[model samples]
Target: MKSDMSDTNNHGKEISDDAFATLIRNQFQLESLGERLQKIENETATMKDKWRRGDEAMRDFTVITITPTEFTLGTE
Candidate 1:
């Protein structure tokens, strides 16, 4: 009778242990997903910065005009 009782308790503990393991695995997966999302966000920010710099550089450029006697440079 004692052995049977212990077996029953062990069986219950095994089920609970499996549940805990699954929970831990899910937590790790969520952490991994968060890291991936952060990396993507960083990359997107870098691309936006690059585009902004390019736009600013374009704005800084000006056109040059030349007449027979003189030359002029102007920005739009």
Candidate 2:
């Protein structure tokens, strides 16, 4: 059996079974790659949002000293 696609490659060329199968497989692979890329982008965005919220929460954080022992801590 042959697959007939009109107006392809500037001519109505009849595609053989093997060529048609390859074309279909390639299209499926491209679609799968696109889906994977979209998933990765979504995951990256979610990670960025989590990081932003974490940073904001840290910004409003406060530490209280329970014991009144003072030791000089210096950073060089």
Locate the minimum summed-lDDT window of 10 residues in model 1: 1-10
* TM-scores for every candidate against the unseen true structure: 0.59, 0.71
Candidate 2 C-alpha lDDT tens digits along 13-76? 7888899889879989999999999999999999999999998777656234333354344743
Cα lDDT for residue 5, candidate 2:
59
lDDT of each: 0.67, 0.78
**Candidate 1 lDDT score at position 29:** 100
Where model 1 places Cα greater than 4 Å from the true spot, the runs are 1-15, 62-76
Cα TM-score of candidate 2: 0.71
Cα lDDT for residue 48, candidate 1: 100
* Alpha carbon lDDT at 33, candidate 2: 100
Model 2 scores worst on lDDT over the 10 consecutive residues at 62-71
Task: Name the lDDT of candidate 2.
Answer: 0.78
Candidate 1 per-residue lDDT over residues 1-76, each given as its tens digit: 1122234435534345555667568979999999999999999999999999998777665223345346445733
